[model samples]
Target: MTFQGSGPLDTSGVSAGGGGGGGRIAMGGGLGLVVTVVALLFGVNPGDIMGGSGSTGSQQVSADQSELQERIDSCTTIEQANSDDVCRLIATKNSLNDVWPTLMNGYTDPDMKIFSGSINTGCGAASSAMGPFYCPSDETAYFDPSFFQELTRMGGSDGPLAQEYVVAHEFGHHVENLTGVLAKGQRMGNDGSVRIELQADCLAGVWAQHADDGPDAMLAPLTDDQIASVIQTAKAIGDDTIQGSGSNPEGWTHGSARQRQRWFTTGYESGDPSRCDTFATDDL
Candidate 1:
């Protein structure tokens, strides 16, 4: 419902499956990635666990190709984009493409993949369990729309903006990849992981602030309710929230609920990507 019917959605860069028919489960480790879910959220290596560049992949998903095709086909109109998941993703991806370049020099769009079960990636093998993530090697963002259903079970909203927040968060990692901050995060401790994750959250807010702006705005004016939904999604995915109330900060990779909410609000209010420099701040 956030899309403004500005124009037809471009799904050319989007793939419903993995690159090169990706669907491979890695040996020894499950599906994993660094950005967003951060190596399956339990210290796994996405690059190491995922079978890398030259391994046999899988067509492991069980979704109906015809059904997926129908959804993609129907997403040409903005009205359809409002109601359909695939269409919404398409619209959101296009919106991000429109927004990021204005904020960063030499910004490039990341490949957005929607999949079920397992998929192969430049970073390695991945499953829906690793949640949404960005692979720097391929410069792509991977998403499992089913993860939204899981978000709902985790006490997060299933609103369109909430879903978009996750998309933006993954793309935030793409921005980090471009700026070389993601590499810094790779060598960080738990505290560093928290900083990177919070920075991504903030960058998501920066996207929201500008998504409906400019002459070619692809989205309608964002609302308070929608922003609140995004906040709920942020809180829902917080490591402290996921680890229960008294979770130790030492063991938490992503920041706490308060920190995530604060950082996102910082970005939204500032509407500046420069304000999202979590590594430079000690407040978190």
Candidate 2:
């Protein structure tokens, strides 16, 4: 699950922000809770446990591009990425940008914004509590690295692949946007929401399959343990698993642990994006 060499990663597409100052306040909640609310409020979503959002009008925030560039400079090798989470993220983004064009036609690379506290996005203003999400309005993915720590508190793994799974999942949303899937409208109930979320998981698996495919592959061949770690992380974040109650498919937005794990496995095993059409499957 590690990258092969110490090569410079192209991080120009990423921007760093110091965080946002004001907005309408959305109650802070755990990862599961935030995701549920965001899914209900905004059709395009992802989940996380953290801070709250504000209600004020959108205020443009600037990113510290110099700081981000410094970090990118330090990550000239895969070894650096293996050691630093931020570097790993940049490397993963590089790999994603490199591989995605081959997977689909007309693929345009999306920008990633790393922020703290809260920030305004094209979708709206969001707080760190929102977790990592892709905004179709801006075609950008947003992340607050601190959420990874919260993820561990929620019984998720801290392994590298586990983290990559998250990045890949959000990026999967960007892919969904490009494919016109995000425009399909978010429906209530697990059946519709689960399909969207699970498809993202499958897309993450698709990324994993090609992450180590070519001579210029960013990562080394994935090991069984690494894949297992990702599965464990997926299970830990399952709506049912996080709820700690008996399965309730009716209220589920992200699917049960088993479903998440199964769909990810499907994409990983098939190594085909076409196989990840969760909407077509009645069994999901």
Candidate 3:
């Protein structure tokens, strides 16, 4: 799918205000360490792992502006978004901002941060290896663009929709946050976490359905093969596939490949956000 043009942006730490990080704290240990390690494979917010307070440690975050960040700020056209990974992320973010408001009443845009190495957040400091996560404390989605390359490493498509699915999934967490169901995902021990994660996949799918419709649409209509690739991407991040032989349903925080694919298909085929109620579905 193609994106629209001239969505110029200037973000501060991850907002419209420009500059570098607000601050940073030294990385931490104990439960923080455990959650970080676990979230490394998926887009889980570490703050939610603690049910609140995402402390990485006790050190201030590094504040230098990166060359990579400079390039992200310069990206203003669809061509760049199509050619560059970071640009694609920005474009996807813009598209999500456009599509979600119609389905969600009083929906507002979420702040986004593009970072390398480490950065500070409303929750706490986080490193790139933790993968992409949304900091509900600050209403921001954090991404280390380099992580997208891991799609192929995880046996998923490295195509545009796959990356967009990731972006949408993180934003889906924001939508959940607004709907007051995000806190339900705090129960990592039971099926609560898995259900929320699957719901996020479905919400991302909901965005995919209407991404190319309406005048505010930022993306071109998706092709059937592109949709299949998104499904492949959804299946790639499944806990069963990620855990391989060690996979256990008892320990699953995110759903299995089948559950993820089914919910995403559910949203795409239905094109209705109301149908994305993974929590109400016993079959999930």
Q: Write the per-residue lDDT of candidate 2 for residues 1-284, one digit (tens) a residue.
A: 48787677777888776445343334442335445543332125432222334433333333343455466567666677787877888888888888789999988999988776567677666766556778778888877777788778877888988888888888888888899876663644446667888999999999999999978788999999999988998888887786666556677777788999999999999889999998887898
Per residue, candidate 3 scores C-alpha lDDT tens digits across 1-284 of 46654556323335321122322223433224533354344555554332222433323232324566566777767667778888888888877887899899989889888876566667665666567888788898888788888667878898888889889989999999999778776654447778888888899999999998977567767889888898898788787777678677877778889999998988888889899888787899
Best by lDDT: 1
In order, what lDDT does every prediction score?
0.76, 0.74, 0.73
Model 3 poorest 10 in a row by lDDT: 16-25
TM-score sort, best first: 1, 2, 3
Error of 1 at 12 (Å): 1.7
Candidate 1 residue lDDT tens string, 1-284: 78886467788778776433332335442213323343343222356445433322343333443455566766776666778778888888888998998889999888987766656777777766677777888988877777878778888899999988888888888898889888888788667778888999899899999998866688899999999998997887777788676577777778888998999999999999999999997888
**What TM-score should be assigned to candidate 3?**
0.83
lDDT of 3: 0.73
Candidate 1 backbone collisions, by pair? 23-58, 24-58, 50-124, 50-125
| Pairs in steric clash, model 3 | 24-60, 24-61, 25-59, 26-57, 26-58, 26-59, 27-56, 27-57, 28-56, 28-57
